[model samples]
Target: MPDARDKAPLLGLGLVWQQLAVGQRFRSFGRTVTEHDLMGFVALTGMQEPLFVDATHTGALGPRPVPGALTHALIEGLLLRGMVHGTGLALLETHIRPLAPVRVGDTIHAEVEVTAIRPTSTGGRAVVACAVRVRNQRDEAVMDYDVTRLLRGESTP
Candidate 1:
């Protein structure tokens, strides 16, 4: 993390959108997942799966697995927070593939690639496709998928 004195100026939404291009990639700052983060997500989403709630019940998958949705949300949030904070209009769709379990205390990073960009029927909006690969400190991929979002253009009306 950059120190306060070393921080760069924030980019505006227009400049952010202008920089989008297929094949461009970016990495969000890493975050260590905590038990509180996981439990809060479960409570907020009402995910009653034993795998997410009980660590004592050791199954074939071992201890309770952090909810996949929470992982996806965190990955997306990191990406947006770093590059396009307050710029996105709506998340059109998301598809997540969990390859490994994300346990508490694991520091994960989100790697994003701009896969596709399509202009919408309305000149003021565009569909952006981001391919996200989430990996832990060990560098093992925990999740991979694509997310589509609607981005507003200069014409907001």
Candidate 2:
């Protein structure tokens, strides 16, 4: 007979190959340098700096800068919902950075690769790891993050 300790759920792992393999190219939401998205960021942060929302200030920069945090959120959104929503886990870890400016008229796309997956220590959940990125039309990485998620299993009725 199985002991109560031995009745715990078994852990499993899953893998996702290079998203580049899914398609040589992926589409991203379109935006512009002069768009509200940039201004909204400055406003939300309560930043009165002219460089963020002021066109004159941003114009000198060649374009407005998209917050690295927002860019990271975009990358995470693409992976958590757009690409692997069905993975059935909540995010566990996120390490992100923005390397370049994300301006208006730039289309944003993502790249995803599964690194690892397994059950949680409690035996009631699972975990997934993914490499996620959001890039502009030029294919230069504007945002990058490594994400981990917790997967939950079914309960018997």
Candidate 3:
């Protein structure tokens, strides 16, 4: 029989601050945007703009254009599930830019590249900056953003 030390862990854990290096790149699993997602987001957030809530609001973009904020949130959720679940301390800053319209039923994923890493003066924590590009199933760049987050170090402070 195998002992606990010889058994492999089943759950995936987030990376600590020291494990990340500048210029390191990571890819997140894809998530598909469905009509239910749009509806729930619109109702929950009260974003009742015609572009999101109106089914017949047709414009130059498309008939079913979802909000850029929703896309960003979905990407962040993906990252939280895949990369930074427990080791991430807090979200310090985020700068977002929408490049293209994302409609319902489009599967999206994020490509993240670490831009910088700086250790804090007090605790054994570090701030990590990443440049993220969101792409749809068709391989089109739909959004771009830069996010800064605080992550815990390997040892307790």
Candidate 4:
């Protein structure tokens, strides 16, 4: 349990972070899918199929078949970048599903919730668990999952 004075202050501004409780929902930004995003993936894993590259192939089916990585990126990368504050920690887990083909201009966002936050029993740190709903611009539920991240208190230095 954190002491009354153990609240971690926000970086720069010195405002105390409101250690979020369960069921806290946060709105995350949505952006149009772009080529640059996939280039990195190709560079890392090598573009192997036209389904992920050739729009013609994607259009053959209907919409562009968005890379699964994009769905994971939105849910894991930018989604909760701002949701958790005062926790000097990194991501521990993430899972997502691509419900439909997403095109180059398709936009998507995350609906997030803070499911749990508690002190790390052995390390004197905090662990936060959350559930995320990744939705497309059409307001369709494309994916959902739970995640956990570690946090540290101000006392850590």
Candidate 5:
């Protein structure tokens, strides 16, 4: 008898590795940054940097900068519903560059582009490289990065 925890979800069959293509681009739905989101990130990741946690702390740098990693996660969450929509196999790596500051009430969107693809040596999976850019409501880039994900495929006999 299989436990419920061991069962895969109904949508488990994501886009197969072979169905992916390089140069494809996706735009994620917009998400607005909030105080709760920022604070929750502090609680979730133990990131208590003043730039993100200190409400009154403001400098020439603009509103307390939203944690870069949090921004990345939120923007990526939007992508997951559409751009990165699929049963993800694994996140191989993420390289991020914080370009600008994000603050409360800022609406953000992600632009994801498939950069490269290669089959795993076993021929049952593939590694996909994607370039992601997160932009604020002002149309300014807040963060940019590249992520590599492993995609599942049909099993070989």
Candidate 6:
């Protein structure tokens, strides 16, 4: 008989705080940015910049330059889905630096490296710091950021 554990849902659970270690690295699955994604984000955020909403307006990066905020949100979505999910408590801080422009149709993913881990003053929680690099389909880095998050410990409080 097959054990029920063998049939566990794929990617249904997130890594608890203890499972993460400094110097550990991971790559998230890729997501392609589409025109619809750009349009929707622009509409929702009210970011009506010509570079994002105007197809005819050509910026330094050329036409269809997606907003840097959109790119960051997409990468953060990937990280949340793939790494933190239910185990993440809160976002403590983030420092973002845009390296290059991301246009529609550019598939992107995050390369993450755990930089620090420290137990919180409260039991059953910890602070985790990570360096994230967002890259496009051409393997060009589009953004770099350091994220600090509060994660749940494996043990119940």
Full-model lDDT for every candidate: 0.80, 0.58, 0.92, 0.66, 0.81, 0.92
Flag the better candidate by TM-score, 2 or 6: 6
For residue 23, model 2's alpha carbon misses the true position, in angstroms, by: 15
Candidate 4, superposed: residue stretches over 4 Å from native: 1-18, 58-61, 84-88
The reply for model 6, stretches above 4 Å from the true place, is 1-11
Estimated TM-score for each candidate: 0.83, 0.65, 0.91, 0.75, 0.83, 0.91
Model 2 ranges with Cα > 4 A deviation? 1-34, 58-61, 84-89, 154-157
For model 4 the local lDDT of residue 83 reads 56
Q: What lDDT tens digits, residue by residue, belong to model 2 across residues 18-112?
A: 22232233333433334676667667878656666665663544666656665665555554444445545456787876667776567777766
How large an RMSD does model 1 have? 5.9
| Model 6 lDDT per residue over 1-157, tens place | 9999987865666788899999999999999999999999999999988888888997789979898999999999999988998889999999999999999989999999999999888778999999999999999999999999999998833
lDDT of 4: 0.66
In model 1, the Cα lDDT at residue 133 comes to 95
- Comparison by TM-score, 2 against 4, better one: 4
In model 4, pairs of residues that clash are none
Model 1: per-residue Cα lDDT at residue 92: 94
Candidate 2 TM-score to native: 0.65
Report the poorest 10 consecutive residues by lDDT, candidate 6. 6-15
Model 1, residue pairs in steric clash: none
- Let me know the TM-score candidate 5 reaches against the reference structure: 0.83
- Candidate 3 per-residue lDDT over residues 1-157, each given as its tens digit: 8788766754777888898999999999999999999999999999998888888898889889899999999999999887778889999999999999999999999999999999999789999999999999999999999999998888833
Pick out the ten consecutive residues of candidate 2 with the lowest summed lDDT.
Answer: 14-23
lDDT for model 2, on a 0 to 1 scale? 0.58
1 against 2, candidate with superior TM-score: 1
Q: Which stretches of candidate 5 lie over 4 Å from their true place?
A: 1-14, 83-86, 154-157
**Candidate 6: deviation at residue 119, Å?**
0.6
Candidate 4 structure quality by residue, lDDT tens digits, 19-61: 5677878878887677777655756778657776665663464
